[model samples]
Target: MQPSHNDQQVDLANTAGDLVPANPSTFSDDDTLSGLEKGPSTTVSSPKIPIPEPADVAEKEPFLYSLRTHKYFITVTILLSLFTDMVTYGIIIPIMPSILEHMGGDSTKTGVLVAVYAAGIMSSSPIFGVLSDKMSSRRKPMIIGLTGLLIATIIFMFAQVYWLLIVARFFQGVSGGAVWTLGLALMTDSFGADEMGIQMGKALIGHTMGMLGGPPIGGLLHDAFGPKAPFYFCLAFAALVIVMLSLLIEVRGDEMQEIRKYAVELRARDLANGIEVKEVVHTSLWKLVTTPRMIAAVTVTTLEAFDLSSLEPTLPYYLKDRFNLTEGQIGLVFIAFTLPTIVSPLAGWVSDRYGAKILCCCAVISAGCFMLVLSIENKPLWGIVLTLVGIGLSTSSFIAPILGEISAVVRRTGDKAAYARAFAIFNIAFSFGMLIGPIIAGYIYHGLGFKWNCITTACILFAFVPIIFFWMGDRKAKMEDVAMYEREEEERKRILAEIAIIKAEKKAAGEA
Candidate 1:
């Protein structure tokens, strides 16, 4: 008869069981067996010991394997969602001033439009994060958000007034939050811990490509067609994503259930093997928000965002005023800021091997120093471009490592629910930073001068260096402790094996 798969598994399990001592001396009631008989038993048992039947082994359909095979389809859908979301975001940048002016608004009001959109995204991020976690379903949220974004884009395309455009932008921001956060969560669920970093790095490549491609395309579309052209294109892309999602199976369905089941089974096995499994309980967002490391990471991210946003809006104007550069020249200079995108995957790989804290601290500090240098120099355009490239490189090096560090720390603390909450807090902080950046830069430049404002911003960024150093030290100490524990565990296992062998010899003597 052909053996069933379960029968094969049972045979393997029984074989493993027979190889180990059934009655070791270490687990005996008494160890006084020195004078026991040492010969094999003469009497043969009438009936053999009943091995567990293969038919009794539970049989269920495999979920994880199926999901793994379908990962590409899921990843592509997510990428498309991210691409459309970024396109919508980038399209507004070049046209913000023009859009506002067409409706009889000033540059300050246009700046408010940017702030409001950021604020909306920040506000909605945590809410969607919690919902995604609770539902454990990325598909519903993604589809709903993409649909909303499509509607918002259509509204913006035909918007004739500033208020109408602001409303559309606000909804777009809300949808944007869903697209980014859910896409990340979905990717994390799809990949294992080690692969997650690489997958996320690859995913960010798409975003970087979008950043590189979207604005230029939007600008060209705006110049050739009209301000409405970008939104129309966005609307079509959003529709394509919606249709793509409909065809793909939901990634977080039975696959996640299987993963959870496997985790439980592993936990049970560890218990059987006398290993302690740490129990992790879901905690409130407020409790997670109070963690010092989480707070520090969030704060640093926020400050970085504020510094970036402040520069983004004014950089073009600054170059125009200081260097008398045309729009195309300014665009070329902006491209330098994005040059780090190409190297970010490599930076992520290195950070995974070395550690994120060191990379983060160096990136922030070096970027600050370079910003100071850029502020002092009256160099040629290429020199300025190089300085901006340095900034981009520093920023990219910091990003993946910082994010990986935050996720690692949160997981170590056994607070899975806190992941999205922490991410939300990070976004909110980033938004606040964005708000502060443009406002501060505007005030500083107007009240004092360009050089002094740049100097102050650079100084502020440098201040994070010492704070990050201390945090890095703490993280290193924790890592050392983990390594020590693992070594001790290995030693304990060796001791247990020796004890088992001694017990088995005693049992053999007693049986003989």
Candidate 2:
């Protein structure tokens, strides 16, 4: 006959217990008295050791996964990194005019400096994305990027030559691309698909803050102290990020084990579904570029960037010429334009719940009409401010929803590794828009007039609405399906768990 399971455990424990001192050297007189009181012939039995049942053991065994546990911390760290990068980029914007003057260059050369930085970002982003997705680890690329930011900050701080300054800006852009790609990809990995939009929105808050505060602080510090003051601030900020990242972020051995398990599970699932998991040699580049969802995301990014960059060069002039506004008034107008971005979190939350189709379409149309209206003659300052505010609010919906949509598509397609490259495409589109928008606006404003530039931009903005309507509408349905799939999967898992528990109980009863 077979020994019972408890008997097996008892025998094993007795064998191991022999290694423990039978009567420890420190055994007390109280034990001797008790033994004597129990009488000589009677042996004292070891306290009955309670062996935990299998189901209890399984229930009590904790999940040792770290990625999900530390997701919020990771998100904060990425946001801080992004904030530092943006601050580094923006710190010099207000001081660029002065810097250019000192170097015997004009505003056009300053524009060249900006363009070169953007060009660097555009060129390096795809490469960074490819490297990140190909690599098993995201931390290495992120660290390298932060190091580049540090080097760029040093260059900007001490460089007396214009060409050196240009080189510094280029490096800065390269670093920005790395952070944007890897950071967003990391966030995607950390969270579920449905939570991505709100998470992106939260990350964007850091960016908006950096943009809002950097220039003003730099300008103020420059006025109060010196040009190098802003660089010093940026340098300190970057250094802090590097240190914080090095200390706070690490994928432990346990996390790596879990990640390997996760990959294996994904591969098994793909095989079960008759989908071929790609080898390392397989390239998703073509697939990424050709996806209609990705095209829509890039298009939205480009148009948004165009609208933003087009305004940067022309808005101040429009306000000055149209209303004779002072510098302070122009600053107020800029604030009014950006103030609506504060509601971006709300937009993201809404997108996550209700889908982004109506929001994206309405935003573009509203922005276009507002732009057309802004071109009207003899508009009051308040009216212009209101119109700009409307434009800002409308445009704020594009980033999070579009990104969430792309992530959803990639996830549905089982190309989870493509997130980094997808965002790299976004960076390219944004950089391209930044490059082309001003050039086109400048040309049109020169060839035609300010009103014509507005007319043209408005028309272009309105055109994208239909594209959004047709493409972005499916997001809600897909999300619903994903939710249903998750629920069904959970139910299946629950049934399996119950069966296993029942089997364990029956096996123990049969042994009895």
Candidate 3:
């Protein structure tokens, strides 16, 4: 133990040599080793090895922070932009008769203008939607659309001839189509699944106000000044939207990133757990057209739009012919239709709690029933009031819930492009309905009468009830299939765990 210093040093060297491998053959034959032998055998230091932190150990964002961040600005911007467009679109409704009279155009020609605007919207929506996806930027599309809307408004403001106004309206429709489709996309990118319905409901409220207020304001302004006043107002509103958008920050980044991250993590977890993820087949427009929920929702929306288009253009004419109501009176009837918008959030809440299918079916049938009542009723004021209230409440009740459901399905299908495509199809159906509805209503009103036309519209609405039932049944069956799959997954996991335990026990025995 108390040996000399040289002996102690030799023992330490022997212990260190024992730690290294005994095989000299493991050393490489290189010029570096020959230089080392001549230079007194220098030792090299090894680099430190680093361990990576687990992905799951990363910090989770607070729920409230996740919910509130970036949404306020985006939601406000979307609301303002959408409100401007809605006002521009609806302002013409109250002033339609006056403008036609001033231009020496008949009711039929006015109906044609409405149809043309809808057609423009339908045609432009898909193009804008596809462009939005390709561009991957809402800012540019929104700005461009708002700018076009402003230019269109200016053209509309200065137009003297009916043809000029029609041309301006067509441009306005193109801009409006982009605004509506892209605005929804922006919101979807900002909000997640749980909050989307509420935020969308709020946005719809703003839109409803524009729809409700714009016609009345236009009516008042037209009555006070002239037919061109609404256009000037729209121009100012469009300018305001541009200014607001410039000041606002984009909110889509965080939400989109979160969705991508979540998707990646879920896929990774499935792979690590030895689960096979199903591959979805991608296709073109035909694939989207054939999706059952999409088809059903689009059909219902289009038919509903058709019924609405038929009724809206003919309403002012019908009222004037029957009761000779003033512009203000007509505006009031329009307001009645929008009155239910005040309760739309409540409707959305109810829809969230109850199923969308029930709400949609009930609302559609109720609206049809009320339209039938309008056809039978003799008193002009009562009929207008009841019809407006019924249609408003019913339509509002259905819209939020059905849209929520469709959005869910689109997400489940794992296609971001589907939203835009779905909306494009919706607009096409809507436009087709608009083109057909007014022409049919105009012909029926001109040839047959007002009462029969209303009855026909009511019957057309009732036709959707059976269709809704069939659609809802299919949705129920899909849910059942999902439940069965989940149960099977649970059972499979249990069996796998049992097998793994048996294998681990055998390994332990072999080691022993």
Candidate 4:
């Protein structure tokens, strides 16, 4: 009455997940790990044989492995790269007026320079994004970009003519494109999409610092050591960034790769499960761009940028004329506008907990209202500063939420999400907004006074708030997203479980 050996073979094949099916002699070598072996011939199932912990198959730790893998270290290194990129961009500001005069250029040429830099960012970001995704590493592109910045700095230092200056600015702009694209993509790779808001907020602190501090530092250096000094200052930072990046490790390359692969395999097995399995999702670029939520995210980023950059050209003049404030004083007032944004980390934290809708809606509304306050006539300087600060604070809503949302959209593309491309779109939108804002604001300010201009911008902000809040978030969508995230978490645990078994079998085989 005993079953034949062939019956046992077929029964084990059915229950063991996947049987070798081939003759056992083919795997007769002692090294044939049981990962490819039958689970067991009995009903209880084979004892869990493989459990690969972090200790198994992990790349050997390199010098400063802990430092390289630390979240804070990754954040700070990116922060310095962003700071250096912005500093190089801004550090030339104080010197531009005098330096341009020597080259027979006027304010109009300066505007051209600004536009060109923005153009460079707009045009080059997508390329960097593609390159980043193709190369599958942020370190190389970042180093190349920073090195390009150093070369641009050298050009700026020696340029004596208007055309040479233009070339240098464009080069700097190209460098800016690479830095922003690769830097942001790197951050996305290092951190989870859920935590993107806070991470982006922290990284942007470098941007704010560069913007606020760059001109002052440039002015001081110019005063003491001439036009070359700011560029010289930038050179030192560039070298430091290069060194820092040299020490930088792409931990995701080593760590998440195997897990992701296992996740993909499991996803294939559960075809209805909707886990993204590609290492790089090949979703058409336009397909992503056309998504409603993606549009909303891009709109928020562009509008926020347009509103902020609009002030750059018009606000200083308004401050100078209305209050008889000196350039130094005007700079101080603008500082108030930027200072509120220093709390972006908190803003990002809020975004992670509650979603981007409420934050973005409230922020835009507050910005519109505060902008209306700015249009009020004869306000005291303190009131103006406070209003600017309020506007700045309102702007904070866009930073983390939009960033997180973009990454979320990419994540939904499943495993093949190309973060670099998604953020490249973001970078282009922002650059476009920055490029056009001043032009539009100048026309409005001249034609209709600052009042209508604020009113016009406020109206635009008003229109988008609903889209941000309602289109981006709702009861049904929120529930769906929650469920999806839970599913993803469960799948992650399952993938880890599989990893455990696979690694454990290999270990057991080695011992046997």
Candidate 5:
């Protein structure tokens, strides 16, 4: 007859009990006591190995076995997706005014079109973020977004009138929001907090490269082959992104973090070494966003987006009218503003150490000063270039800090937190900035001229200094919380070690 499960456990315990030392002096009393205290709620016994049902394993493995699921590969796939969108977005920037001019429009009309794109992103981010989390899969939402983006690009390619072009941009922004929100969620799933900052910085490299090259490439292509050439270039990159995405196979939480059946020492060591599992708490979206630090971080994201986008409506016209610069030369000037941001990874390393308060305060102030200088009307080409270079260096310093802060707000929850919604809030703020920047900056440029536009932008940036200082930073509260967690981890390790010893003795006695 088969032994009952409880009978088997008792018989096994009796057999292994023989190996225990009678005096019990070899073990630490504190550790043994702690385990006893914790163990009354559940029996501490030898672990049983799990056997996956054959049919279940077969179903999951058959197709997934052929795909790449490594964490590094996931990063690459997401980065490629980001780069594709950014390149296409920027490739059209330098040519937008020209497209308008063909339709008997000006920079003000171009500003409205740019704002429409941002409006799409702002409206779509939260919807996609909610869908991505509820759906419990990143790849499907990402593919759907990409397909829609391609369709929008096709429309943009052949748009003969201004309103049609605006419609294309709005749809393109919606799809772009999906890619960014889900891509960030996927990255958060794959990486732990310790490395997330650097990864985010590296991710922004895609944005930086796109801004650095897109306008120049667009301007040059428009000059050489016509407006259609730039759109074709974007289409090709999007196709390659589809291939990279197809190679990815998403790794779910249980599969990615499998543990041995009864590896007590490994578990204890892992907790001690900073790989932690915390007490679960369901933080609401509003609660996360309303926190002081989070608000500051979101505000900074908006301002930086504004800082870059404000240039789009104002700078192109200013260059054409003031310096008589060609489209290619206007695009080249933007390179000065974008080139310095390539060191984002290094800046991320800094954020990990020093914190956001110093970076945000200093960056905005310096950028304002540079903008004030750039506003001077008599400056030659060299002076304007120098001012842009300064703005780039100063403004780029804050990107990684705000990004790190945004992730840091929820990172203590470890694997339990929802990342898509958090980043969706970030996207909302960023897109809002992009939406308002062009409208305000373009209005000022059209009414008061370019000088007042720069001055007004600088004044607005300077006003944010105190808010940045008051709210954005590394807080003592976080340090105290980390200390508390570490102490709890020590207690947990001791308890686990005692359990391990008991299991070892039981197995040895059973063998005897």
Candidate 6:
């Protein structure tokens, strides 16, 4: 037990040699050393470790991936921005008349205040659209737009003069054009055509809520506190959104590289699947926009906006005159119009599953029919509400489908990069519709009556059906685009696998 020091050292060395293994080759087959070799057999217990697939990983930890994280965050951020914009704009509606009356401004001036915003949007949308596409990154334009919104909110909060208010509204319009045009472009770019309908439908909910809740919230705030209360609240809201945009939104600067990487991956996947990747031919933006298909989609959107704007301004007046209804009753009629729009996402889902052409055509025809019926003299209150609800349902189909169609067409035409401009054109068209609808409806109502105005609008809506049928083609091309996109995604995964293999080999060599 008490051996000499040299004897103890010899005994320790013998124990260490036994633990180390007599032959290094004996340890090569160990489970812990599986990846140490360039080509290790997985016939042992390695398969039991249960490695996860990419999709499973992505699903389990979406936030860990940059692409998924950015997409989800941006989608929510844009919706909130849209909601904030709408609420801010709407809140002013209930209070504007009072403020104008206090300042001794006439009804004409109030109309101008409303119309000027649309004018600003109409003028700025196209310019911003072109600029976004040309810019290195979309984030700059988005930030600039949000900054404009903040500045406009500050002006609304502090400015007492009517001219300053008008100026502030113009700024707000410019900001709106930027946000909608650039935001939509970003959405289209990020999500692609396949998912656009649902994404748009979801985003539209924010717009609807803003439109529905803005005036009431604004009125309550103004009534409870003071004129400054709504503005101050909106200013704080805008500031918060701006901070969110600055911190959270990320637009990859090297978008071309990313796209090419995706394309390469797709190519590799196609090779594995025994498919071919064909070179695609793209059309010029001008040629693309001027096409019958593009025109029809744009016209559908414009007419939809026209119908809504025309109805909104005239409804209260008509309700007041016909039913001798109080403000509360008039508000209920507006709800009837808005309630159908709640199902807009369902319309989008349907359009995505089926096609936009038939849906849009049917929507236009139905809306026109309802518009004609709504003009009936001495119509019952229930009948009027039903017609309004029908109109809302039909109109709800217009936006998501048309926007989806535009995205599809742009992708089909090979102008995959021009969605921003295309949607910008859409924004411009909508702005024009908004600007003219109320004014034209008012003029007709003054000259002829509400019935004549409805008649004219119905005619315009009816004209869209034939155009849609003739211009908007079948869904064959869209299916092809989807195939192409999926192939590319597969190629991306294949390339990633090769990269992983190479890295693994290098790591194994280093360890050896």
- Name the candidate that leads on lDDT: 5
TM-score on alpha carbons, each prediction: 0.72, 0.72, 0.73, 0.78, 0.76, 0.74
Per-residue alpha-carbon lDDT of model 5 for 274-309, expressed as tens digits? 544322345567877876777888888888778767
lDDT (C-alpha) at residue 185 in model 1: 65
Give candidate 3's error at residue 231 in angstroms: 1.6
- For candidate 5, what is the lDDT? 0.67
lDDT (CA) per prediction: 0.58, 0.62, 0.62, 0.66, 0.67, 0.63
- The regions of model 5 sitting more than 4 angstroms off are 1-67, 253-281, 412-415, 475-512
TM-score of the candidate numbered 3?
A: 0.73
Ten contiguous residues minimizing lDDT sum, candidate 6? 6-15
Q: Could you give candidate 4's per-residue lDDT for residues 1-512 as a string of tens digits?
A: 32211111000111112210122222223211111112111112122224345456454667766676567777888888888887776565445556776676543455566556677788899899877765546878889989998998898788888888888888887888888888887787666545667888898777766655565566667777766778888899989988988897775453245444444344444444443232222555786677677788888888887787666656655765677654445556656755776778887877776777777888888898988888898888898888888887888656677777776666555423377888889889888876777667767876777787788888888888767765564333333333433334333344555655555565768942
Best to worst by lDDT, what's the order?
5, 4, 6, 2, 3, 1
Over 4 Å off in model 3, which ranges?
A: 1-69, 254-283, 473-512
Backbone collisions counted per model: 3, 0, 0, 9, 0, 6
RMSD vs true structure, all candidates: 12.8, 17.8, 19.8, 11.5, 11.3, 16.2
470, model 5: CA deviation in Å?
1.8
Off by over 4 Å in 4: 1-51, 54-59, 91-96, 102-108, 216-226, 255-281, 317-328, 444-453, 474-512
Ordered by TM-score, highest first, the candidates read 4, 5, 6, 3, 2, 1
Q: Which regions of candidate 6 fall more than 4 Å away from where they truly are?
A: 1-71, 102-110, 157-162, 219-233, 247-284, 320-332, 379-383, 487-512
Clashes of 1: 3
Predicted structure 4, TM vs. truth: 0.78
Tens digit per residue, CA lDDT, model 1, 324-401:
764445556667766677666775675556655666687788778877877874777778889878876766565555
Best by TM-score: 4
